[model samples]
Target: MTGSSHPVIDVRDVSKSVNGPEGRLDILSDVAMQVNGGESFAIVGASGSGKTTLLGLLAGLDTPTRGSIQLDGHALEQLDEEARADLRRRLVGFVFQSFHLLPALTAEQNVMLPLELEGNRAAREKARTALEAVGLGPRRSYYPAQLSGGEQQRVAIARAFVHSPRVLFADEPTGNLDRRTGRHVCDLLFALNRDHGTTLVLVTHDLPLAERCARCVQLQEGRLEPLA
Candidate 1:
């Protein structure tokens, strides 16, 4: 599988369950999916349908309770936390719905973090370029609080792309913006995908956004169904 160069992500019979107050709760079950390199994919479903959980597993942020997940040829379940973190740093980038920016860091600093962690000497310059790419260059010095909701989200997008990761995971990226703003953000996201040929796995409720991807999978009652 490693020698072959087809799939970037492969999940086989994956399931996730958690211990709840009532008992065990199954969040996802028997989910199998694959996304090829340089492909754009989407997971669309209603709230509590395990879309985010699937994204986390794909990104190696969380381990599935059952089955195997191979991300970029590495087995996620076999990696320790430190190894997973290292892999994420090296190969994965994430954009959260909440825009999880460090309050103490300005937009530039936030975008620079990943590059700095990777020991890149041009962190500041690369960060600046990413911000400029997202049309937030003028607000590079501003903290998250100083920016509008849309501006803050733009910063997050910049941060996610600054490292030029092999794969990008976005969970409800446009959830916080108005319709027009969301459309703009979506366009920017796809533009980045086009420019970099990055593999994209997005969990979104936006039908148009989902339709833009090469493939779309839907979650219903913790099970995956093909969206035709």
Candidate 2:
């Protein structure tokens, strides 16, 4: 399938608020950002700064209370949950800090889940290749509990990249790993980005990690400011 020339993610004047015990609390306010195809962008902020919220909004995992978000040229605000989920299945992949793998599934099984969900006939072969790419070929049979934190995270990364998604959203992908392991994971992520031309939108608090991205946007009270 030919890739779209339009920006993979476009957010304009987006704001989100929630009801607090006392009153309404705005998590994000008037935030605008764009991530072009194959670009690596970072959202950096302190805890409670709404970085994750912005990432979720950009990935169409959550809706913005106000403003607009266009993902792969489709207006997200107009789509219902099912439609948004369909779009996500087609264009997006995500890696989370927690390495959310199914405990009952082996590493290969976890990677195979997405391909199987898409009804691909080569799911096992594809899953094997993906695990091998992450240097976990021998551990393909290991379940999440059988692997170390770094290994589990690598499996998660493989799962996200298995389908060669056009847009990848990572939320503090290395947060659970040690410094050395985190560096290795980051290297793998960038290598995949280079080889597949996947657009990467990462939310992180790690300064050096954020610096590795092509562009960095900092969020404060849900507003974006380009990092100098």
Candidate 3:
């Protein structure tokens, strides 16, 4: 799927607002972007700059107030909640700064969760391979509490890509780690993105991290701004 002609994500005239105590609060205003298949695109902004809000919309976790989003060629606003969730299950993967692994599950079990949800019979085997890819094969039996921050994030990354999603959304993936460990995670992410030909949509406040992407767009006080 290298150099794919079709866009995996397309956003047009999108605006998102929420009712606040003061009045209406706009989180995004008429944002438009097209992320081509297999492209690495970054949504970079400062804290409270609506980066996460836009990521959620792109991933179909939430809907925009005034426009359409096409994810993997499906109109997200046209899908109901369950249909949108199903779409996410089929096409989207995510990594968060908090390392959202289940506390009670072992690394292997955590990695297997997505496959198991889809009733995959080879969940265990696939999870083992994913963990091995992340250099955590030997720690498959360890719980999240037993692993260091870096190891936990590694597990999260493995779990994210285990089902082989079309788009991988990462929100400040390195925010919780030290500089050295963060670099390792970044390398792993890009390697997987390359090998899998997966569309990477990264949201981060760190300019250096955002710079790694092929293209980048910044959000400023809820408006889209081109980054030089």
Candidate 4:
């Protein structure tokens, strides 16, 4: 899927800071990284180490206070919020720790949301295929509340992959599951990544999970420390 040597995601001299009650709080500083197309990258850190913050920036959910980021060759800093969102819809998918499924929607509907947002007329059929891919075709009618933790996560995974985005951002994807379930979810994630050639950027506190990525880096005191 990666046809060129250019990076799919690039971050250069990025920093983020916010004004807290006491004073300015620096959450990230001087971060630089590149993730190529079809590659798997991991960011690991302790609590308050800015892992999530960095993930948000990388995914264009937030902007760095200084420096630049490019996603799929688009300069995120040059895009407005609306334009950034449009770019994300066209190229990005996300899976999160809590599953982030809408309780009111059935599994199929949850998986169809992305396509529906894009006005895709075949959303239902595409969603069915995605659910089947995740081995949840038989459970399509179930709501998040009726499903187990692992099942819900699988549905979330289905939703994330249904659109075949160029990039997938997973933040603590298995955090709420038991060890066995976590392992299963992790396997499914990597399988999708490999099979679909999606660039994967994962943020995790689970070291074993981090080790599974092709490259890994740690965020210590808001700075990137390479691990591999």
Best by lDDT: 3
Write the residue-wise lDDT of candidate 4 on 79-168 in tens digits.
899999999999999999998898999999999999999999999999999999989999999999999999999999999999999999
List, residue by residue over 164-226, the lDDT tens digit for candidate 3: 999999999999999999999999999998888999999998899899998998999998989
* Tens digits of per-residue lDDT for model 1, 1-228: 111247989999999999999999999999998888888899999999999889889888899999999998999999999999999998988998899999999999999998988899999999999999999999999999999888988899999989888899999999989999988988988888878888888999888889998889899999999986
1 or 4, greater by lDDT: 4
| Model 2 lDDT tens row, 40-102 | 889999999999888888878899999999998999999999999999988988999999999
Q: What's the lDDT for residue 146 in model 4?
A: 93
Off by over 4 Å in 2: 1-5
Q: Model 3 Cα displacement at 126 (Å)?
A: 0.3
RMSD of each: 2.7, 2.0, 0.9, 1.2
Clashes per candidate (backbone, < 3 Å): 0, 0, 0, 0
Model 3 stretches with alpha carbons more than 4 Å out: none
Candidate 3, residue 119: how far the Cα is off, in Å: 0.6
What's the ranking of the predictions by lDDT, best on top? 3, 4, 1, 2
Q: Sort by TM-score, best first.
A: 3, 4, 2, 1
Clashes of 4: 0
CA displacement after TM-score superposition, residue 76 of candidate 3 (Å) = 0.4
Who is ahead in lDDT, 1 or 3? 3
